[model samples]
Target: MTVVVTPLSGSEKLRLREVFASVQDSGSLLGYIRTYGFVRFHLRVAIGKCIDSRSVSKLESFIMENGLLDRVEGNANVHRWSEQTQLEKGDSIAAGHMSELSGYTRISVTQNNLQELKEIWDQWGNETKQLFYGNYGNLPYLLDVQIDERLFRALAQFWNPAYNCFNFGEVDLVPTIEEYTALLRCPRFQVDRIYSRAVNVPTFWKKLMAITGMSEQWITTRIKEKGECKCISWDALKGLILTHPDETKSVDVFTLSLYGLMVFPRALGYVDEATTDLFHRLSKRVTSVPAILAETFRSLGTCRKAGAGRFVGCAQLLLAWFYSHFRLIDKVVCRVFFEDYSLLKDIIVSTRRVNVPEENWIALLQNLQSKDVEWRAPWMIPGEILYRCGSFDWVPLLGIWGAIGYVPLLVLRQFGLRQFMLATHGLTQSEFAYRGADYKKRVGEISSAWNKTCRLKGVAIGPTTTLEYVEWRGRRVNDNIPEPDVEGARPMEEYLQVMP
Candidate 1:
C-alpha cells in the first residue's frame, strides 16, 4: 500500500512561518524554541501586549475560539460580607459552633460541614507545608521552624501550661537609604543634585562612607575626633558649625579639602572666598603648607613636561592660594624662592593680570587649550588686564579652574577618575565634553545667556555675536562685525569648542 501525506496549503504554511518568525523575534521565546516551538498557542502573545480596546477584542476572540466563556460560571460576589463570615473557610471551631446538641441521641449532620472543611483543607494545607518545609535546610529558618518552643513554656497566671511561640517586642529593622534620608530630611539614594535634598541619617552614613572609603576604621576615627559633638560625617561637620558658633578650627577641614578637590570646579555660585578659606584651612591641617607648595610645584613641573603647560593643576593651586591671600603668598614665595628663582616674577606678572573680566578669562582659556608653552606666558597678560578691570568675575573662573583643570588632573593621578568625572558632569554640562552639534548649541546658549547677564549687570562687554560683512546686505547699512582684540582671540567655533 502506497500511503502519501497531503501537502500543507500555501497560506497555511505562510501563517505557520509568520508565527515562527514572531516567536523567534522575541529573545525569551527563541531561547526555548527548539523544545517548546512545536506546542504553539496564540493566547499567550495576544494577552501580553493587548490592552484596553485591544484587550477586549483579544478576550472576545479567545472566548469565541475556545468556546468555554459561554458556559463558565460568572460572579460569586466573593467580596460580600456577612456576620457568618466569622466561620472562616477552614475554621473547625466555626463548624463546631454551628452544630446543634441533642438531648438524648444526637444525629450527625456533617455533610455540608465536611465538604466546606475539605475545600478549606484542599486550598491551604499544601501552602502551609510548603512554607515551612521548602527551605528548612537553611539554618536560620530551620532553628525557628524545627524547635517547638511553645510546647516547653512554663505555666503562668491561671493556666497550668503557657505557650510562647511568638515574640512580641518590636523589631528594629535596618534603615534603608531612603528611609534614613526621609527621617533626616536628606537625600540618601542616588541623586543628580545633593544641594537641594535634605540630608538624613542614611544619606549621612553613605556620604561618610564615600568620603572616608572605610567600613570601620575611618568611621571610628571620625567618631573619636568628633567626640560627642556629632556623628562623624558631613552632617557632623554641619552640626559642628551649628554648635561651636565661635571656633573655626572644628569646621570639617577634611571635608572642605575633599570638596575643594572634588566639587567646586564643576558648579557655579559655589566658589567663594569663604569656601576657599575653608579648603585652605583643611589642606593646611591635612598637609603642611610647605608640602602643599612642594606638591604644587611638582605638579606644575609634570604638566610642563607633558606639554600641557605649567599653569594647569598644582600651578593653578599655587595661583589660587596667591589669589586667596596675596600678602601671604607673596610673603611665602618671596621668603622661599625670591633669591634663587624667577617664580616670584612669574607670580607677580600673573597677579597683575588677575582683574580680567570673566568672558575675557574664558576666551583666554580657550586659546590656551591649543597654544604651546610660548603662548602661555602671555596668559599673565590677560590676567593683568582682568585685574585692572577690577572684575570679581574671578569667582566663576575659579570654578572653571577647579572643575576642568585641577579636578581632572587630581583624580587622574589617583585613578578614581570615573567618580570624579561623574560628580563634575552631574554638577554642570560644561564640565564634561558634549562634543559636535550638541556642543555648538550649548556654547551658543551659554554665550547668549552670559551676554545677557553682563548687560544686566551693566558691565561693558564687546559683542559676542559677529555680523559678517557679506555682499548679501543690499538693503541699507553694510557694516562689518567689529572684533575686539582680546589677548588670545580665536575663531568663534574654536573659542567655543571644549578641549578633550
Candidate 2:
C-alpha cells in the first residue's frame, strides 16, 4: 500500500484540529503514531494547529525517516499585516518619513573606477597575486562585477530593516557573516577577533604611516578633507603601489585602496579616514566579516528608510551574494566542493551583465515565493552559528561607518535548520551611528557584549525546532510567511506585466 498526504479540506481541517485537541487532552498521540502509522498524515495536518508535546519526538523521528523535514519546515504561513507594520515602524525610526515612501527611492551606487584597479592587478604574476590573495582572499574578482543598477534598486526595496533580511513575498534571505567570510576566502580572518570601535581611535595619518611605513610628513601632506571625514586620493595610493620600494608595503597600500574604493567607498576616487582605521586593525588580524556585514546592513537600512540615497556599501559583493541565491548556474561537481575553488569568481563569470528594467525587477521581487529562493547558498556549509551576544538576546554588530543588530535565530532555515519566531525586542534600539552624545557609551556596551557570544552547534538529524517554537511561529502576529499584496490581484500578474 502507498500513502499520499494532500492539503486538508475545510471540514477535514476542523476534524484534524479536534482530533489533535482530544489527543492532547488524553495524552495518547504518541501511542496513536506508533500503532496506526499515521505519522505523515498527522504532520501534514499540524501546519497551523498545535501539536501535542508528547508526540513531538515520535513525529520528529518519522519526519527524519521519511525525509519530510523540509516540507514541514517550509510550510510557514505568510503574515502580511505584521510585515507591513514592522516595516513602517522601522522606517519611522530610521528616516522619520514612513508615510512619504510609498514607492522605492531611486538608488545611487558608488561610481568607482575598478577597471583601473583590475588593469593594475592583471600586470602582476601568479606568485604576486597569490600573496595578495593570502591576505585579502579573492577580493580582486570584485573588479569583474559590472554593477546592475536596476536589480540593486529593486533588491533594495525588499530589505526589511525590522529583521535585517530581504522579505520578498514569502521568502527571507540575508547575507550572513559566515557566507561573506567564505566568499572572502581570506586566511588571515580570525572569527573571534572581530572589529569594534575603540574609545580612543588613532588619527588617519598616523594609522596610514603604520600601514605604509611612510613618513608622518608624507601621510599628513597627502590626506585631504572630504565632507566630514579625511581621505587620501587614489593618485597618491596608486603612486605608492607602483613606486614604493618595499613589495609588502606596495601590496598593503593596494589592499587598502581596494577596501576604500571597492568595499566601503564613502568618497569616490579616495580612501576614507574610517577605511584607514579599519585597515589598520586588519593588520592586527581582526576579522573584517562582521564589520563588512554591519556596514552593508546600515547602508541598506538608510537607503530603504529614506526611500532614496547613494548606497555607500560594497555593491559588487552584494550583487554577487544576491546572484548566488537567485540565479540557476551550473551545479558544483563533487571535486570542486572538496578542492580549492572560488565561488565569487564563479558568480562573476556566470552572471550576465544585461540590465533588467528597475520596475520589472521590483515587480518580480515583490512577487517572490518560497519556491523561488535557494535558502542556503551552495558555498555555505556552516559548522555552527553565532546566534546570540554572550548572554544577551541577539548579536550586535559595529561597523566603521555605523552600527546595527541582527537575530541569527530568525534565519536558522538558511542553515538548513527549521524556522521559528525568535525574540527581537531590543534589536532596533541598537541601530545608530558614532555621532550621538551617548554613541561612545553605546559602542562600549556593544563591544563588551561581543565578549560573550553564544554559538549553537549544527545538528545532523532530528527537528531543529521544539514543540513550543513551532507553536509560537504558528500563533505569532509578525510571522515570516509571504502573503498576497494589498491589491489582492493574482500574485504573478504584476510580475508578468512588467516582464519583457
Candidate 3:
C-alpha cells in the first residue's frame, strides 16, 4: 500500500503529544515503554530473555538454515542475572521474601517450561491468552486481521531471539535498478520536516535493506562495528566491504555505502572527524554521487545469480519495503528518488531494457508477505522478560496467577492498539487505515477535535493506497504518483491512461 503523509495541525500536535506521553506511561504501550527511557536495560532484558541456551540452540538451527553464524566470535554476554529466577507478570515479590520460595517453585529456565525449548514461541492457554489479549485491547479483535498483520509486519527484523538486540529480518530478495532509484530517492528532508515520530529514522538506512537485498547478518555485523556511531565514512565503510569481498559482506557493503551518501551534510553531526573528512575528500573526486548509487545497484543486480529477470526480485523487494514503510515509518515513505535524481541532473545511469512479466513482480510481493507471523502477548513484557524471584520454566499460560506464560510480540506492542494518529483527509474525513474493529467512528471524532482544538501540519493520512509499477514511457516506474522529474510530481494514474 502507498504511504501518504497525513499532516497534523498545531493544536493537534499538543493533543498527540499528550496522547503519546499518557500512552507511554500506561502499561498498554509495553513496546514503546520498553524501547524508550532506560531502553538498554529493557533491550538487554529482551535479548537476555531471547539469548540463552535456547538462543544457542536456535542459532545452531539458523546456521543450518543460513550460512555460518559467524567466523569471528561475537560480543561476550557478561551482564549477569540469576537464570533460575521466576518473574511474575506485573506483580513483584519482595527482595527479602525471594529466598523463601526458591525451593518450592520458580521460572528457572527460559520460556521452555511448557514445551520443548527449541524455538522462541511459548504456548498460550486459551483463557490466559484471552485475558492478556484484552489487556492490549484484543488487537486482532479490535482491529481488522490486516491491522494486526500490518502492525507486526516488519518486527521480526528487529527482535529475533537469535541475533538478540534489535536486529534486521532477512528479506530474501532478488535486486533492481528502478528499486534502487526509489530507495536512494526516499525524501529524507520532507519526511524529517513533516513526520515527527521516530528518531534516528527518516534517513534511508532502514530502507536500504530493500535496495541491496542484503542479509541481516550484514546489518548486525555493521552494528557491532559501528556501535553508537550513527554515520559512517565511505572510505572506511566501502574499504571494509571491498577488502572483505565475501558474498556475505554484500550486506554491510550495500547498506552502509548508500546511507553515507544520502545523509551527507548531516554526516559531521553524527560521525567522527575522520568519517566526515572522508566524505568531503571523496565528493571532490566524484562529480555525480547519485550516478554512483544507480550504478552500484545495477552492478548488484547483474552480479546476483537469478536465472533471468533478476530485476523483478529487486523491484519486488523495493515495493515490499515501500509498502512496509506505511506500517513502519510514521509518515509516507515518499518516492523521493525523482527528487534525489534531479539534484544530480549532470549525471546519468542507464538501466537494462525492462522485459519481466508483471505477474513475476506480483508473485514476489505475495512471497515476501505470504507467511503469517504470530506471537503471544505479555511474555515479551519486562515483567515476564525480566528474571524474577521463584517458579523451571516460564509459564505457558497463567497457572493460578502463575509465573511463566506465553510470549507477546514486539511489533504488536509498538504499533497495534497504541496507534499514533494523524489527521483525516478532509475536515470531516476520518482515515480508516488505523481504525481497528471497534474504533472506526472514534478516529473521525478525534480528527474533528484536532482543528477546533489546536494544529502539527494539520494534514491527514488517507487509507492504504496501492503503489504498483505501471510501464511509463518505456521504463518501469514505481510511485504513488508518477513523474519523470521530482518537480511538479504527481501520481502515475494519468500516465497510465496511455497504457492498455
Candidate 4:
C-alpha cells in the first residue's frame, strides 16, 4: 500500500511563499530553523498529513535551483555506485539470514510475580500504602497490569534498531521521555537531575545499606552474585516488607524491590546491584525516566538484532505506554485529566482487548499509517524536549545496564514540533554494553554529556515536518532491506510455529 500525502492549503502555500521571500540565503533556512524556533504550525502544517507529491517534487526542484541542497562530501575518485551496490548486497544477505529464523521469542518478564507483588501491596496497612503513594505516585498500580506477551512479541518484530524506533510502514513511533515521566508521575523525581553511571561505583550491599538503613553485615549476608551481577532475591525483600520494625525503612525496601523487579527487571526474582545504584540516586531526586527509556530501547534493539530472544525489560510499563499511543478503547473520562487520578491504573484496568494472533498482529502493524497513530497520548501535555547533551550533537541516555544515544531531533513531531532531517551521524555507534574494558571511560563520557543537556522549550502548536525531512524519511524506507515474505505456509503450520 502507498502512503497518502496531505496537500497544503492555499493559506499555507501563501505563508510558505512569504517565508521563502524573506530568506536572504535559501541554504540558511535549515540553520535558521535550528537556531531560532520556527512556528510548528506555520511549517509543514501536520504530521501523517505530509506535503502532496506534486508539491514535494516542486520543492525539491526549487531547492536544487537555489543551491540549497548540501553537497555530498567524499572523494570524487571513489566508485560511489559500486559502494552503494556492495552495501545493498550485504544488507540483503543479512536480511535473508534473519528471515530464515523463527518468529519473535516470548518475553521472560514474570507477570504472575508482579500480580503476587500487588496482592502483597493490597494487604499492607493504609498508612504504608499512603507513604508509597505520596512518594512514588501510583507506581504500585503497575503491578496489576496484565501484559499481552503475544502482542509484545509481534511488536518486537517491527523494531528498527538502526533508527531506534518501531517502523510500521510510514509511521515511526517511540516512547518519549516526557510521556514516561508523566506516566511514572513520581512527585519526588527531579526531571533536571538525571541518573548516570558514576566513575567510582559502590558495592550492592553498601547501596542497600544506605537505602534501607540496615547494617553492612545484614546487607552482605543477603547479597548474592548472579551471572556477573550482584542481586538480592525477592523473598528476602518480601520478608523485610512484612517483618521490619521501622515502617519507613520497610517502605523504602519495598520501593527498591519494585524498581528491581518491575521497573528494570534484569533478572527473574532478584533486584540487580545496578538497579540499587540508580535507586540510591533517586533519594537525591534524580529522575529515573531516561534510564527506564534507555533500557527499553536497548532491550528492544537487542531482541530485534538477534531475531529471537527473551525480552528482559519491563513489559507491563512498555505495554501501558504502547496502549496510550495506539488507544484501542474509547476516550477515557475527564477525570483522567485531574491531578489525583491515576492514568496508569485506568489503563491497567481498562485494557481488556482479546488476544490477537502473532501473525495477524504483524500484518496489522505492517500496514500502519500515520493517520492510525495517536502521535501524542491524550494524558500528555507536551513538554520541553531534551534534544542535545552538553555540546554533543545528539542526546546520550544512560541506563542501569548500559548507554545508548537518542535522536530527539528526529522525533520532534512527538512534542508537537516541526520535524526535520537532522544529520544522525553516530547514533548507531553510541550503543554499548556496560561491561567493556573501557566501560568506565564510556560511562564517564555519557555522564558528563547528561550534565550538559540542552532542552528546547515546547511550543503550543500542532505537529508537522519539513519537506526535506519527508524526503529523507522516504529515502530511508526505500533503502531498508525488505523482510522475506511469509506466504504459502499452511494455517496450521503457521499457528504451530514456535515463538523461539
Which candidate number maximizes TM-score?
A: 2
33-139, model 2: which lDDT tens digit per residue?
Answer: 55333534554554444455434554444435433323222233212222333344432123332333335566788578888789889998888888898887888
Per-residue error (Å), model 1, residue 396:
27
The TM-score that candidate 2 achieves is 0.75
lDDT of 3 by residue, 345-454 (tens): 11111111123333222222222321211111111111111111122111011110011111111121221121121111111111122224744344333323322311
Model 4 score (lDDT): 0.66
Q: Rate the local accuracy (lDDT) of all candidates.
A: 0.24, 0.68, 0.24, 0.66
User: How accurate locally is residue 415 in candidate 4, as Cα lDDT from 0 to 100?
Assistant: 55
Candidate 1 lDDT over 1-500, as tens digits, reads 54343343333333332233223221232242432423235323422332344433333343244322211111011111111231233211211232121111211111111222223223434444243222111111111111111111100000100000011111001111111121112112221111111112233334444433445554445542222122333443434333443332322323343233222221211222223332333222221222222223233323322323212122222233223222211222221111112232233333322223334333333233211212112112110010000111110111211211111111111111011111111111122222345544543343333222210001111321113211111221111111224554765343333324
lDDT of 4 by residue, 435-457 (tens): 86997888787777777776664
| Minimal lDDT window, size 10, model 4 | 70-79
Cα-based RMSD of the predictions, in order?
Answer: 37.4, 12.0, 28.9, 12.1
TM-score of model 3 relative to the true fold?
A: 0.16
Worst 10 residues of 3 by lDDT: 103-112
Highest lDDT: which candidate? 2
